[model samples]
Target: MKTLGLALALAVAMPSFAAPPVPLNTTDVDALVAKPAKGTRIIALWALDCAYCEQNLKALADWQRKHADVDLVFVATDPMSQSVTLEARLKAAHVDTVPSRAYAESTPDRINFLIDPAWGGETPRTMVIKSDGTRRALSGALTTARISKLLD
Candidate 1:
């Protein structure tokens, strides 16, 4: 079927990063937002237990393939000790090609607060920040339309 071919092609196009994630502290996030490295940075916050995170990652990775200016950064909110699981999950999604991070500190609540006080410790939270100090966020499994809206 045509859908099967498309799926196979997407799988081939996306390769696993398979590398361990770097440690992520609040300071690191603050510094990145203060000076984004690319035209737009999309920070995806996910956890090992979140069922929808992989789907979001795969979709976002596909979108990134089409948009050269969009940078996708993934952060596992789980503790750094779970790097093995993090790496495995990211590999499964084929989003290991991009830079990834794991929560370095143990205080998840505080880290989440530092990332965004408005957020309520939700999984699969996505933050889209632009170079001009403007940003938007959406939590939950993102739809193509919602992802597009975040950029606009």
Candidate 2:
């Protein structure tokens, strides 16, 4: 009985680990663009220091809960060293359960170029890629109505 009690206590005291962010490179980004999925995919690029990113993340989490069929991908533009904080932020937003990737390269420009040449390294950048390979990129926090429209 004492052993069972101790085990239960230990379990309760243990910290819950959030899903680790996968490393994303230029090749991976290229592949994602080249091999378009059967349905629409929401690709969100964020950073830990970006204030707007938090709002977008929360909105995305809520949106994802309602649309289970939508393919939502989170890309952290921060370096790999900040993966812990990135995970924490995602967990707090309740979107950590979805697939997430972190920029592996130290140079932000390289990663930014891989994502989009026109992008001026903005946080909370979102891209809604349709099944037909067409996409709409929006920079900044997304409104609930916009999210719904994008999913539709």
Candidate 3:
């Protein structure tokens, strides 16, 4: 009886895990970017296979901690089949609690083209979309200074 009670207590004490990633297609991505709202919205693209992506996620997570009011969205480039691994990575970066989506398509090239034809499917790609829908794209691992500038 004590063991059973302890198990229940542990379960209740644990932090709630994030929900599974939703299907993200070209139309969905377009809708997300086009959605109108105040302030700047950050759309970060990353993958579990990319080392630089991990760094970028950690930087973004730290920046997010200080700027809770800023809107941020994460898009995992890995296929939906890798959602478990993706979730674990996000948790490690402390950004799993944020709004996140994963690629539903099997073909990464298609997803890349839809996001930005100019982009060559780079990991750690970040897009900052302003309230007016103007955007700035940054590619490569994010630094603290870069994050501060983007947020400011």
Top candidate on TM-score is: 1
Residue-level lDDT for 122 in candidate 1: 91
Q: Write the per-residue lDDT of candidate 2 for residues 1-152, one digit (tens) a residue.
A: 99999999999998666678999877778865442557677888999889899789778877877876667788999887888988888888867777889988767788788777778998889887777877777888799988876656
TM-score of 3: 0.83
Q: Distance from true position, residue 74, model 3, in Å?
A: 1.1
What's the distance in Å from true for residue 121, model 1?
0.8
**Which runs of model 3 end up more than 4 angstroms from their true locations?**
1-13
Q: lDDT by residue for model 3 over 48-72, one digit each (tens)? A: 8787987887778777778756688
lDDT of the candidates, in the order given: 0.85, 0.81, 0.81
Backbone clash pairs for candidate 3 read none
Model 3 global lDDT (CA atoms, 0 to 1): 0.81
Provide the clash count, candidate 3. 0
- Compared with the true structure, the alpha-carbon lDDT of candidate 1 equals 0.85
* TM-score for each predicted model, relative to the true structure: 0.85, 0.82, 0.83
Sorted by lDDT, highest first, which candidate order results?
Answer: 1, 2, 3
